[model samples]
Target: MTGVVGALVEAWDELRIHRLRVLLALIGVAVAVAAITAVTAAVDMLSQAMREQNERDSGRSVTLQVNAWPATAEAASTDTEAIAAQYDLALERYGIEYSSRTLYSPVPVRFPDGTRGVDMQAVDPDLGVINRIVPVQGRWFVDQDVDAFAPMLVVNEAFMQSLGLSDLSTHPTVLIGDTDPVRATIIGVTAQRWTGEMPSAFWLYDQFERWWHVDPQMGQPAPTLAVWVPTDQADALSERLARDVQLAAPGWQVDVYDNRMNGMSGLDGATRWIGLGFGVFALLLGGLGLVNISLVTVRYRIREIGIRRSFGATSARIFFGVMLESVVATLVAGFVGVAIAVAGLKAVPFDRLFGSALQDTPPFPVSAALVGLGAALAV
Candidate 1:
């Protein structure tokens, strides 16, 4: 170990003496390493953003969607509350941690101008976990919101704008329903799905059922139960949930299927490969330039090498002494580059870059730094 330390010290000393000759090359190497590391981290964040966006649409990985509806007109009025109960029981039986029952209906809201019908979603608090629903301002629903005197709402940006509200700072309230408009407070605002999406809001399932009357023509949409489970258990759970739900709600059409985003692994893989390819190409160019500089430096140092040989230095010592200079220089460069990359990434506004706040924002991947360092060492 001492011998190795001495050799490393000697190499570092040589690098310091010849740094002026290799300064530009070392800078190139540092830039290349930073580029590679940054690209890797960027790809990881992009993939995470894509995954979060998909989760908002279809729930997270291994999400099982359960649908149950009456098969005949006579059974059309099948008790939805009972179905929800059965869904809860099933979830309890499996000890599922994240599950939510969601139903969609339109409710009339007394806006400042006039009463307007707005799209409404009745969902449980767990929906936030299963769907990665991050509110842009304020907070999502909690279990306590269920017992509040009035219903709580989480509306989109458009919904808040229609009510002439800038934010939830004042705890905005809007009257919902036409008969006896029940006052609902807007606790959160979510980003619009598009620039001009219609005003929509989410209400807790139980509160919505108790407060909002279902239209006869627009009868309550069938509730879809979303349960997030382990990927490996999805197929088995899907089959079991289908059988159990069917038996629980007799004469109803019951279906269970995986609703998590599909075919994204391929796209993520391609993106990573493409980004890595660019990084590697840059690294090669820098490596080639460094190699040329090193060759010229070695030619100029022939007398120094010969003097060491005359002083009884073995061939191995000379070889290692020469090689360690490049290694030590690159290791230093890699460290500086990685530090810069980490700092730059931390300062990035990821929410704006991805168009949404990432629920599980990936940390600076350790593997990315490893790759950068490994490439530097290879060069």
Candidate 2:
């Protein structure tokens, strides 16, 4: 340890002695590290944004959708609701993970201007967990919200503006239903990524069910369930869920919609490849820069190295000294570059820069900095 410390001290002194040369070499290394950080961070952010966008368009991969279609067109929606409720018990038993049932229906909501029919969706609060429905202003619902007297609502920017509201701090309330406008409290504002200027309101199912009347038009659209399961377990769980539903209701048609089957089910694999490829590219660049610097440094110190050898320095000590200098200098340059990159990212308005598809610009990807440092060290 003492020898190592001595070597580090020597490396620092040499760095100071050859400050201009070291600085010039460091510039290339610093730029390379910075580029590595930027590419890695950008790749991660873009990939996640794309995933959220995909989930918004299609449900999440391994999303198990249950369609309970009764034979009779005139069957009351209440009957369908009861059948759907049966899965809750079975799910708990199987320990089948994350699930949300969404009921989509046209609902009349009164804005200050006039009442308009909006795309009303009632889903559990955890829909954000199952699918990425990020909040722009407020928070998504919680299970405890069920006890609240007034219904909690999550509205899009367009819907909030349509009602002449800008600030989300005050818990805004809106009226639902044509004859008697039942008041509902606005709890959260969804980032406009998915809705994109469309007027929509998301509600917690039980709360919204109290006021919204379901007039059976060809029997209300079956509750589309979004179920999350491990990739390996997805097919089996879907089968079990469909079988269970069929056994529970003799005449009902249980259609399990596999979103992955549609296309691009290989997103996980693709993400891995993207990360690996970017990492290789970054290391390649950084390695070349560091190698050039190391070569120049060795050439410049050849006389000093020879003098040390003449003074009885072993080959091992010389090798260790050279290696230590390269590593310490590279690490220092890499850190400086990381600091520069992080500061530069601070100026970026991620939402505007990446477009609202990425609601909030994520804090600088820490993995990026780690990868940058790792590359600098390895080089």
Candidate 3:
């Protein structure tokens, strides 16, 4: 141990003496490690951003969507209602924890100048959880929001702007319905899906039903139920749910499908491998450059090696001492590179890239730091 310590001290002293000569090589190592680590972290963040975006569009992972329609055109309106009731019954029978009923309908809203038609979604409270809905202002729907006397609304930025409002601090209210025009309160504002997105709003299913009834003759689509279940059980429950709904409403076409796509995970995996491939290529190029510089450094110290050989330094000790110099230099560079990568990750504009802030921003991956350090040691 003492001999190893002395050798390490000697190696460090040599590095200090020739620091200027090794500076360029150390910089190469640092840059290479930084590239590997930053690329790895960026890939992770980008993948997560994409996954969240997908979740917002579709429902969360492993969500089952149930839809039903009468097989014959002669089916009565009561049959449609029965089908909807059966969907709810199936959900209840399975004791599904996260479920929602979603319906899209266009409603007339009184703007400042005149009334305009606005697209609205009437959804149960669980839709917020199933769809990963995050409001930029105020809060998402809660169970109690259903019981409010006035209809509660969560509108997009464009919808809020249409009302000539910038924020929800004043508790804004807008007249809804073409004939009756029940005053509805805007409780929250969400970001527009894209720039110049048309005005849209969301309402509690019960409140929407109590106020504005959507008629099928008006070209409105029927409400569909979404139930979030475990991935392992999605296939099994899909068939069972479909069968149950079919049994509840005989002579109806009932279908239950997994709404969330499985492609996101595969896409993320591909991105990780591609990013790592490029990182590895960069590391190899940097390593080659560093090796050339180290060779020149060794030649420059040939005289020093000869003198140490005469002073009872064995060939094995001399070899290890020289090898230790590169190891120690790379170790120092690894630390500097990891620090730079961490800072870069924190500085990245995640919201701009992902279209929204990530609900769960991952911490700096320990694997990234390990990859950087491992590359340094290998070089």
Candidate 4:
């Protein structure tokens, strides 16, 4: 232990005396370490954001939609309600929290100014799964509104701007489904949705009775009935739904989109490979620096090393002393590099660059310390 301490002190002294050379080497090491940390940190943040977005887009619970026709047009149709109940039971049996909603095809809102586009979605008020819309403005619909003759509507930002409305709280009048222009208050704006299939819009299930207007609800020109389900159970639910639909109506097609399956699912394996490549490159660079620094120290301290050996110092001690100096210099550089990277990252608007997807990510971990220390010693 005393010998090790003596060697460490001597190594530290040597490193101090060659301050300029050590500093230059440290800078290279620090830069590499910092780069590694920054890249890894960014990747980690993005990965987490993708996961969260997936969860938000494709709920953690599984959902299934079934469109069944009544045996007779006048026979009180309870099949749709019954099938929904069965789905709910199956989900509960699987220990999955589930919710469902019945939607009308998106309704086209024709304003007096000739702005024609589909913007409204009618939904069940009680279903909690996908009913909660991230409101950028007012509030979601209440149960009473769903039953009212003239129900309230929630509009999106794009819809509001198109209608020449400045504030959503002003209760703007808009036309729905070729009906006479009815006045409904704008309750909320949707979070900027990037889906290519639908234009920006708001909820209006309370105001319009979509089922009453369309014949063979499935044959209607608009998309109706969206069900949200858990990611893991999405495939199973989709299969079950297909089977249910076939049993009920063989001519209708069932479609499913598991939000969890979107955006960079295959990238995990690619990212691991990329990370490994960078790590190997970093290791090689560190090793090269270590060899160079160690050789230089050994060459410069031939006389000192000889004297130490004469005084009973072993070759192992001399080698270790040189290695220790290199290790310390490299570690110091690594830490400095990590600090600079962290500070620099704060200056960039990462949220804007990556989108709202990663706005609330946690700070990068300090595990880079281990990497730094290990790389320095290896070098």
Candidate 5:
């Protein structure tokens, strides 16, 4: 240990003496490490951002979507209601924790000035959880919101702007109904990112069914039940739920759909491939920079090596000492680079930078920093 320590001290002294050379090597390693680290972290952030965007559009990972229709095309108005009851029953039977019923209906809303058709969605409270709905303004519906005399509504930013309603402090009401307008309170406003400029609103599924007369004769969308389960159990649970629903409502064609396929296949693989290519390029740059420094270092340190050899330093010791100098110097440079990268990322607001793409991504991924340091050491 003492001999090793002595050799390390000697190697460090040589590095201190060759100030210009060490500076050049350190600069190269630092730049390379920072480049690799920043690229890795940025790619990871982008991937996560895209993930959040997709989840908002579709449901979250391992989400099971069930589309059920009564066998007879010309069904009584009672049939849709019965079908919903059976679906809800099946959900309870399976002990599903997070589930939502989405009933998409184009309802005309009457503003103070004029009325327009808006995409009104009726959903259970869990719909926001399954879809990861983070409101920029207020919040999603809660269980207590269901019991209110008037159906609680969450509107999009565009919807609020269209109505020319600025303040959300005082609860505002919108007239939404097929016949005489059933007044619904706008409790919250969502950021206009997921839903486009088109006006949109959300109401409690149960309240909408109770208050609004959704005449099946008018040709409206059948409610879709979105269920969230563990990723490993999604397929199995969905299949079982389909079987149960069929038994619950005989003559009902139950179709279980996996919404995650499109998101996972289309977005994840593409981002991974793009990131892998860039990561490799970064690794090469870092390694090549270190290799160049090491090559030049040996030529300059030949005199130092000869003197150490005269003092009984073995060939292996000399070789390892040279390597250690590079490792120590590069390691320090790697840390500096990582610090700079972190500072750079923090200086610029990533959330603002990504805007819509950014969601729930941690301020910085420590793993990416560690990986950067490791890659620098390898170089």
Candidate 6:
């Protein structure tokens, strides 16, 4: 330990004597390390945030969708009621929590200015756990009004803008399909949808039933049902549904997706390789700088080394002395690089790109710093 301390002291003395050279080498290493640290942190934050968002968007709480066909031929055999019961039972059997909803069609919406378009949706007030449509402005539909003739419309932000509607207080009137105009009130607006290649619009499902002339007891076919299952059990639940439920139409499809699966296929093996490539490049650059500094220091100290050798200094000691100098320089630069990276991350706005995950944590990677220090010593 004393020998190591002495070597470190000597290395520091030599570094102080050649302050300019040390600073230049330190700058190079700092740049490399800072770049690696910041990029890695940003990527890690982005990947995590995206995964969480995908899970939320996929409705991890409960499955959702409208049933197209009913189990019974009677007009009273609306599959909506039976399917909700099935979802409830399934959740109980698996010791999992769940919810469900029925979607209605597009209702004709008229703004205060009389501009109009079809706003599509239908929702179950009680069992909708996944994609719970919280009202931003007005209340969600109550059970008493489920069969009411009155239209209760929930317009999304984009739909509101397109129809020249400004505020929920405007008491916007909407026509359900070709039916008589029903005064639907604005209730809620959803947050912006997840980032993707597709464009998304927000709307209310409760008012869609009045406009589309759908009677829950009319026993009509539904277009689709969205279901949310626990990520771990998504595949198993989907398979069970497939084997147990007989579809009225042979071509009907059951699609299952979870949050983790979203954007996952796109990440691919190439992304890992790319990260490794950048890491390797950074290590190589840092190592090269250290090696160049070592060679120069050795060249300048040849006469000193020769004098020490004449005094019975071992080659092993000389080699260790040289390596120790390189390691000291690299470790110093590595720490500075870590500091710069942390400061720089604080100055940037990564929230829009990475969301709450980056906002909640520090961006430094301790392991990377250790690896960089080791690589510099090896070089």
The candidate scoring highest on lDDT is 1
RMSD of 1: 2.1
Top model by TM-score, which number? 1
Can you write out model 1's per-residue Cα lDDT over 1-379, one digit (the tens) per residue?
9878999999988877777866777898988999899999999999999888888888889899998878877667666666777888889999899988888887999988999988899999999988888888999999999999999999999988888888888889999999888999989998888866999999998898789767533665468898999998999899999998888777789988896448889889999999999999988887888899989988988999899999999889988988888998988888888888899899999998888778788989999999999999999
Off-target runs (Cα >4 Å) in candidate 1 are 1-6, 215-217
Error in Å for residue 264 of model 5:
2.6
> TM per model?
0.92, 0.74, 0.91, 0.74, 0.90, 0.71
lDDT string, candidate 4, 1-379, tens digits: 9988987788789888989878766666777776676666666666766655555544433434444444444532323444445545555655544344545454556765674757345565434335334566777666666655554666666676677776766667665655555545566666656644444554544345432354444433323345665566678867766565445443334454544444466775567458646865775675576567657867887998899999998999878888778767777776786787688777768667766635347676666446545655566
Task: For candidate 5, give the lDDT of residue 235.
Answer: 83
The C-alpha lDDT values of all candidates are 0.87, 0.77, 0.86, 0.60, 0.79, 0.57
lDDT string, candidate 2, 235-293, tens digits = 88888888887777667677887767654536645765776687567657756766887
Weakest 10 consecutive residues of candidate 6 by summed lDDT: 195-204
Question: Over 4 Å off in model 4, which ranges?
Answer: 49-79, 85-95, 102-104, 108-110, 115-119, 123-152, 166-177, 180-182, 191-199, 204-213, 217-263, 279-290, 357-362, 366-373
Every model's Cα RMSD, please? 2.1, 4.5, 2.3, 4.9, 2.5, 5.7
Give the C-alpha miss distance for residue 68 in model 2, angstroms: 1.6
lDDT at position 369, candidate 5:
85
lDDT of 5 by residue, 211-322 (tens): 8766666755368889988888888888887887677666667899877667456666777668657765866776676688778767887897899899998899888888
